[model samples]
Target: MSPKKLFARSAAMIALTTASFSTFAEEVNIYSFRQAFLIEPIMEKFTEQTGIKVNILFANKGLIERVKREGELSPADVVLTTDISRLVSLTSQDLTQPIQSEKLNSNIPSQYRDPENQWFALTTRVRNIYSSSERIGPVDITYQDLAKPEFKGKICTRSGKHPYNVSLVASVIAHEGEANAKVWLESVKANLARKPQGNDRAQVKAVKDGLCDYALGNNYYLGKMLADPKQVSWAEAVNINFPNQNTTGSHVNVSGVVLTKYAPNKANAIKLIEFLSDDVAQQMYAEVNYEYPVKVSVQPSKLVASWGQFKADTLPLAEIAKQHQAAVKLLDEVKFDL
Candidate 1:
């Protein structure tokens, strides 16, 4: 070939290579409600395996509205959050797409994943109660027992309106029906030492302050308290109890993800979801956050298993999604404020 022609071809090839590299450097934007520290390791692993950078926008609130406002211009390729109701809201609003992956199907149980596959449970946590070891004699067991007259003015919980508590209420309504659940909530509320005004961790703090005998909380708070050197005393003050073991077992919730309906990189999104569902990634999620791995084969961390095996209410989580409206109504009817 002529020298001039060869030079021209080489210049074009170099230009194309540079352009491709620039595009490759761009990140996969994610709207995640999870704190970065909790999920950053998994993101790093994903980047290492696929060379696709992840840019997370983490917030505790307003994320859903932000995504909706972005409309067709939204840059998010995925959304990850910590509850079924939130995921269902996204799905019902047409914000996400149903995804299919053999690995995800095999790893996550059918009951935990959406029947239509719009979202999936990446990990789970059981809602349980913790009590002051010294103050509460004879260690009360079931969630129902908290409402007994004996425990009045000695209980602590986060606001009833919080999604965690709301979902728990919804689960009760599902199992025991609205009338009974309302009565239980009323009795339980009467037992509160103070008006519900704090987050779960704060309830643990209240327990330490001698303001309450028991605090309703998810299991991770205990793990987090134990893992933190500063919070060791708080952990010491509270004894974890897996509630309702004699009957319905503890209430469970999840941290899950869904594919954006208009994801610019749909194929890559599915690949990412499937990768997160795999046992390896699932285990990392569980360990990092003290959540239960969605993969059945992965064992719970020693700390979690030490609480003892308890039957989880096997009610399909999607039912909770469908009943979210009813849950909200009941929360209002019961005057559970935050």
Candidate 2:
């Protein structure tokens, strides 16, 4: 071939290679347990500001198993999930890698992140008690109060095995010890208005229907319920109460993010995590989902703020993660869902 032709061919190859490299460098992939609608806006904002493209694969379950199956070949760069159980599962299964980011450490409180930096919470929600507006009125309550005999046949909740309830039970075990936690679990079960059934919103609906006088639920669900036209009345029928303000404080759980063990875009993944922890994304979380921001400087949305502030238990999430299995065991021992 002539020298000119060879030069032209080399130029074409160079352009193709550079294009591929640019595409590879500018994108990050996420395996998310959060629904797309709930997080997509913040991700879009991140992409808009940083010029890095975001790709998300959303699912309600099985993401951990999927990543395990994919192994080192996994395309996942980040994993976003709710509850400490899922976070602990990722670390315990060796599906995540520890990250050391000054930005993350500074933005997130120590209690809300893994000590080893394997996972970081982006948002928190209280495991709150909802009382009938007409029947109970606004009242101070505690986790221990639900077990009192007067509350028998007056309380409603989702299944105890659910991550939210499991985490709440784990917090109890952390504070009250395994033996006492079991007693608490048995008593709470005995007090159930009916066998534990349905999601947190359903429990609130039962309250509206007068099937129960009180229900246990995550705080954000109140925002969600009120926003949804069909569910608005359910939310209106009850007042959200943060439990244990005078004692151990409300049990708080988080929706958090982790860097994958074999992230194909590690730098971009870290950037995304940091972005989520920053004020922009944190504010979106507060406004859109009615969750408490993990960043200390960011405040809750006006509506969420209207619920009235109360103390959140300062127990480190690591301790709650440690007691997770024992919490599940206690639930089973007492046949909590049965």
- lDDT (tens digit, per residue) of candidate 1 on 1-338: 47875464445334432122111234566778888887788988988998777766678888788668655445567899998888988888888888867878898999899999989999889898988877763364988898799988999998888889889988888888888888888888888899998789899889999999899999888899899998888888888888887788788999999888866566767777888888768878777788888888998788887777777778889986676777778778877663
CA lDDT, every prediction?
A: 0.81, 0.91
Worst 10 residues of 2 by lDDT: 14-23
Question: For each candidate, what TM-score against the reference?
Answer: 0.89, 0.93
Instruction: Supply the TM-score for candidate 1.
Output: 0.89
Show model 2 residue runs off by greater than 4 Å: 1-23
State the displacement of the C-alpha of residue 260, model 1, in Å, after optimal TM-score superposition.
0.6
lDDT of 2 by residue, 1-338 (tens): 47875465445324432122111798988888998887899989999999999877778998899789767666678999999999999999999999999999999999999999999999999999999999998889999999999999999999999999999999999999999999988999889999999999999999999999999999999999989999999999999999999998999999999999978789998999999999999999999999999999999999999998889999999989999999999999999999
TM-score of 2: 0.93
Best-matching candidate per TM-score: 2
